[model samples]
Target: MKEQIRCAVLGLGRLGYWHAENLATRVKGATLVYVADPFEKQAEKVARELNIGKSTKNPNEVFEDPTIDAVIIATPTSTHAEMIQLAAKHKKHIFVEKPLTHDLQEAVQVIQTIKENNIFCQVGFMRRFDSAYMEAHNRIQAGDIGTPLYFKGVSRDPGSPPAEFIKNSGGIFLDMSIHDYDISRYLLGSEVTSISAHGNILFHSFMEPYHDVDQAIAYLTFDSGAAADIEASRNAFYGYDIRGEVIGSEGSIQIGSLRHHDIQILTKSGSTHDIVPAFPERFKNAYLNEIEHYIDCLRNNEKPSVDEMDGKIALEIALSAKKSFETGRKVLLSNPTLSLD
Candidate 1:
């Protein structure tokens, strides 16, 4: 028989609420025990909607709850490290949404604390769980793609965030393109060795306060002597266009397209198809799969497939890209090799 894991959802914002609802209604072998957020009303609303027994405005209370076995942290970027450290100290397992910590040193410290406390920590890198990306990963590991040599990735949002939000988002590389960094590594099975990047404030000038650009392109060199080219944009009015392809010695694998539906209309004008306008819609299944994987790992006493170390390494790449953009020279990475064990 599987043990039921008692869980708490931290941060009642968009992604936080999504996790809470899933834990309450979708996930099995897990019970939603509590919901916490800085906003008491939002927490109460989400808790009520999920029919959870408890709701609080304070996240620390969730960590202090002996009945809670694990916590899903959907908190703001600024609070991630503190929450992670606290959860580890309280001997609770954790599943935190990505860019583990805005500060690299903080990220390293959080991982060390989890290790010292023997707590299981899962970092959310949802793309790794996406079926298309999973198929690509499996094929590369199986040698079907044969000696993967190069990669190309594109991640564009339908619109930009408010200026106030961007100001605290740690810049475009850390805030957004970090996913591309992870996707590149997940596909190539190698670490980034160096990076060079260029940016343009092609659309939103409000990002100036944070030194964030609306559009940027970066080229990454990997440990296996492979390279990846990635471009990210805060505004892609055509929809949330995200796609990637890996070119290997033998063949290649491509994933994603502008998708809302499969059908396309054709006529004298041309072919027309709907485009997915948001990340949530496009990667909904992936997010669910990742959260479920975390709960299953707790039940089975197994380590997460993608853990804190994966998050740290991806952040390192994003940091390097940022420095490269600032200096106009390739920034060599000094990241310690990430261990999957």
Candidate 2:
């Protein structure tokens, strides 16, 4: 019989709970032993519901436990670097949610900590695990699409988050479009050379105080001569719509659909179908796939497909985009003066 990787999940918010549920029940070769969050009741409730062995209000306990082999840090973006550094100090393998840190210096420090500890660290860019996106990537790699030339991506949330979240979310690029940035690099197989970005507080006035926006867009020029346009919005009253397309010299590959099912009702007045209402529902399988992959990598002593370096690069691109938006100029990734803080 194969050994199981004992695990713990920190944070019990929406995404955190989902990851904990997957680690508890779905992921093979994984045993969820502990759960932690600042809210004692929330942590205890999640532990009880998931049948985890222990629950704690302090995350330090999770890092201190020698029995745990890995931890999924689903805590707030602001706390990622500290949690990651602590976990690395404990020599525990880590799976952290996206955008390692809003600040590039902190990202660099987190990368250094991971390297110094020689621990396996995987970032949660789950789009790479999605079936359609994976197919597109495979086709691009197989040369079925020849040399990619252009990319277009759309990401929309059904509604805006509270003002508090926006204030610390590092704005739209880091909180939302960072996914698009990561997937663009993954599918285009190139580094972003420069980016021009623009944003506005179209509907969410609450975002204005934070200098954040409800709608944003960016144009990316890649080293491979491929260009990309990404649009992100929190006012997708229609639904949680996400779609992407890549045009290559030979042909083009398209990914995603607005509809949840193939069938749509036809009527004299109109036609309608179910739409993806939220990210968790849309990327459920990808979330599970990422955790399973993390466990598999741990058991096999293999490196994760998406590592801290990828996280760092993605954060750099996101910061570049934000800087471009703020200054109303195209920002080069090579520019050394860039800083989010």
Candidate 3:
């Protein structure tokens, strides 16, 4: 039998729990050997639930463990760069959830460490592996959507996160719109040249204190002369709505909708279908595929599709949008890699 790479998942939060569970049972050629969280009880709880052999509240335990070959970092945004650099120093491959680092310089530092250590790293832009988005990307690449000119994306949550989370989330652009930034780049196959952002606090007045917004729209100009219109919202009360489309000279393609399932109920009230409650359920398959790809790369000694550079670019676009929102102007990327901070 082939050996499986011993893996540890840092942070036993909701996303980390899911990451560990996926690596534990779903992703072949990978083994979940340890799990960690700052809260000892929380770490113990999920470690027991996952049937993982080792669990610790101290992140250092996972980083120092010689048996572990890699780590999945699903920690809070602030801790990402630290965890990643530590894992790289340990000679472990890494798979990090997105928005790489809240600071661009830190992302550059992390990427440097990964390179110096000769380790593999994959960022969690799971949409790239989603069947629907993949189809659009493939078709666009194949010229099915000839000469792509415009891109549109929508992501609205059925509910809002805690006020505390928002305080530390680096605002809507990095927290929410970052996903769209990456998706736009993926579908358009281009980098954003300039960005202008408009934001308002339609609801969620709590954001006022932090200068964040409940809704935002960003306009992006790409190097390919293509433009993208992105829409983001914190409340979709109906459900977790996520969709994207690409418009080109020949035709266009669109994805997602309010409908959650095929079966629509018909009655005097009118036809209605369920709505996907949240992101986890909506992108479940993509999550699985991404983790599987990580394991495959580990086993084959191949580079994962989305690496640190991808994470850095996506982050730069997001930071630029944030800068735009703050300044009410179009921020130019004088250097694609230039840090807005």
Candidate 4:
């Protein structure tokens, strides 16, 4: 096992910057050696702020560097497949954000390439590492929840992203609901067999040109006969709210809270509490834990908990949901790994 895993970060955007910060400061056994972004200034700024030795506008520099053992890919969804394949080709382990690729064919190809390379690839499904969700998962596995039956998830973003981002976000299901789909599968211990979805433009006119909706809902059926309903929105005026509930034959487990802290103030007028403002605030620990897990896997020469197959299946589920919404019907996934042909 390597004494320390040298790491590089690609795409220093919102999530990318956060990941770079974690690697530089919080995650042990990880050394943030390189940072890259198309915007020269952004990359240089991040590099300077994080005290990284190297920063570049081109991603090739990171992959070409033999000293770097791994990379955290926080690039856009459309670019995920190419970046992952490139990293794999360089024999660098990868930690990429969710929905492996926007296209199923590309996702299939990416999976094959990763397998051929035989490098560790971890998908960013941070919810699985969250303390609350992990507790629920452990209890459910221990039979505390008996036989899982139903899953309900709610994910509401306070506001929509810019038009440029929405145009390439792969719509709401892939962009937002993919996490819920993955977590539903994780907690219910089942593969998504079919999905029915619905969505509307709602408040964001900018999304219409992109055919993306500001809000959506998906109903999913699992191979274990478990069911799930997930709701996603980009117009949560109050705050960034995320919650999940798993109901079982014996009992139920609820996860998440709107408040950032446990304490709430009570008054004669009403009760008030600080609401989670965004994803970073809501899943801070989860983000840190996921990166640490990736580093640990590298040092121990072990495969990541969330691998290429999980990423592929989650993308498939999201694509199915999008199809259902477009066709106004339920889409069945007869073969989880159905061929592109």
Which segments of candidate 3 are over 4 A away from where they belong? 335-341
Best by lDDT: 4
User: Using TM-score as the measure, which candidate wins?
Assistant: 4
How do the candidates rank by lDDT, highest first? 4, 2, 1, 3
- Kindly state the number of residue pairs that clash in model 4: 0
lDDT of 1 at 250: 98
Query: How do the residues 29-138 of candidate 4 rate in per-residue lDDT, one tens digit apiece?
Result: 89999999999999999999999999999999989999999999999988999999999999999999987889988988888888899999999999999999999999
lDDT of 2 by residue, 1-341 (tens): 34899999998898899999999989989999999999999999999898989999999998888998899999899999999999999999999998788788998888888989999999999999999999999999999989999999999999998887787789999999999999998999988999999999889887776889899999999887899999999999989999999999999999999997778998999988999889988999999999999999999999999988888889999999999999999998763223323
Question: What residue pairs clash in candidate 1, if any at all?
Answer: none
Q: Higher-TM-score candidate among 1 and 4? A: 4
If both were scored by lDDT, which would come out higher, candidate 3 or candidate 4? 4
Candidate 1 — which residues are off by over 4 angstroms? 338-341
TM-score of structure candidate 4: 0.98
The TM-scores of all predictions, comma-separated, are 0.97, 0.97, 0.97, 0.98
lDDT of each: 0.89, 0.92, 0.89, 0.93
Error at 142, model 2, angstroms: 1.4
